[model samples]
Target: MKAKNGSMVAYDGEMAFKKLSGGGEGIRGMVTRRITGEQMTVMEVKGHGTCWFADRASEINLVGLQGDKLYVESSNFLAADAGLRTGTSFTGARGASQGNGLFTTTVEGHGQVAIMSDGPAVVLRVSAQYPLTVDPGAYVAHQGNLRQSFQSGVTFRTLLGEGGGEAFQIRFEGDGLVYVQPSERNTIAGDV
Candidate 1:
């Protein structure tokens, strides 16, 4: 499995950790990530049995993917099966609103991934009839065939400091599940 560097807490069996420079994406991926500013450091863990991984005691959620892609922020990603492919992709305005820059991490293929959040994560289903809108700071990860668009409620009132607390959000349509943390992060749009 590939896990975030320095996230391993313990293991009951024999294990080896090898630092995967450039997020295990090789030279080309390294260059791409560096240029996009979505850099992530990963380590390959092998011969593991009951391996434990954690980040600052954050809550962890396990997601299973069956040949589908998972979109997650680099900060929330914990680990994934080695068979899965991991990379970076552009996130447009949603990323900017969260203060996470313009790119986010992606995991694909048939495998399980572990994601971390500040608090327990709520899995919200988004169907054709029931779309879901999420605060950028509260978003953790999403899976399935989902289309995400940035939504803003800012108006003239916002300029006068009377805006709703949630002025920026990411709306998900199509069909998928979105993971949202109970707590929101400190973001550029936190007060908007």
Candidate 2:
């Protein structure tokens, strides 16, 4: 119904909810876990919605959920709902085997979902003039206002200091929002 200061609210029926809780004053969403079955904790992020886990996900089942408009960094997002398709860009991490990267897909209808690893997220405003550049691992979801493409100019090989282009990046242009996490994913020994 209402949020604290420094927070923006966007509601789309019960399918979408957004809480910009950070900066200046401080606004945290109300969260409550409501599941007592067998397995992990199923936290209902009040207006934040819910996240579904896939069998391949490591640590937690699913990550964060988005109602209205939300941003998620790479490490924070274990996996997102299959609703959005994978973008053509990817990047490899130090200890990563298959190259941990970012993906993008348009949310059908009038809503979308985002999963996160840690707590509340930070929302950044992106426009044509001031685009956003994020680490390959901290992105979660974005509004359908931007375009995803490989970085131009410097070749991947030159950027990675390798022989060829092994690392990849997503170039976001136009206008939209990006979600990022403060933490990177902790690699498990046998995660691959």
Candidate 3:
């Protein structure tokens, strides 16, 4: 398994951890998903029976992919099965806010991916008829066939401090599961 460096808390049985590589790409090519060049620390855990990984006591959730792709923020990605392919994809638009990311980590293949959130994350179902709109800060990840689009409700009032916190929303339609953390990520727009 490929996991974040320093994320190993405890493990039972024989295990070996090696610094996979440097320069952003992890052992399985897992990227931090930052085009601005932030180093991603990753390590390969081999011969492990039960390995525990955690980051700041955050809640961990497992997402299963069967020949599908999971789009997740680099901050939420914890670890993934060895066979899963990890990479980065360009997120089309910026939310008129500074904190929403422009690139997201992409995991493909048939395996389970562990994601972490500051709190528990809820899985919402998006169907052809029932679309879902999510605050970008609260979004964790999404999987399956889905169309993602951004809706910015920025107005002059927003600039003058009379607008709601939900000035930006990410709409998702089609068939898929969307992960939303109970708490919002720290974003510049949150103050607005």
Residues 39-117, candidate 1: write the lDDT tens digits.
8999999995789999999999999999999999999999999999999989899999999999999999998999999
lDDT of all predictions: 0.94, 0.36, 0.80
- Backbone collision count in every prediction? 0, 18, 0
lDDT of 3: 0.80
Question: Which model is ahead, 2 or 3, in terms of lDDT?
Answer: 3
lDDT ranking, best first: 1, 3, 2
What TM-score quantifies how close candidate 2 is to the native fold? 0.38
**Distance from true location, Cα of 86 in model 2, Å:** 12
TM-score of each: 0.98, 0.38, 0.89
Ranking of all candidate structures by their TM-score, best first: 1, 3, 2
Show where candidate 2 strays beyond 4 Å.
Answer: 1-106, 111-114, 152-168, 186-192
Better of 2 and 3 by TM-score: 3
Give the per-residue lDDT digits (tens) of candidate 2, residues 13-46: 3433244222111221111101111011112223
After aligning candidate 3 to the native by TM-score, how far in Å is the CA of 87 from where it should be?
A: 0.3
* Candidate 1 positional error at 84, Å: 0.4
Candidate closest to the true structure, highest lDDT: 1
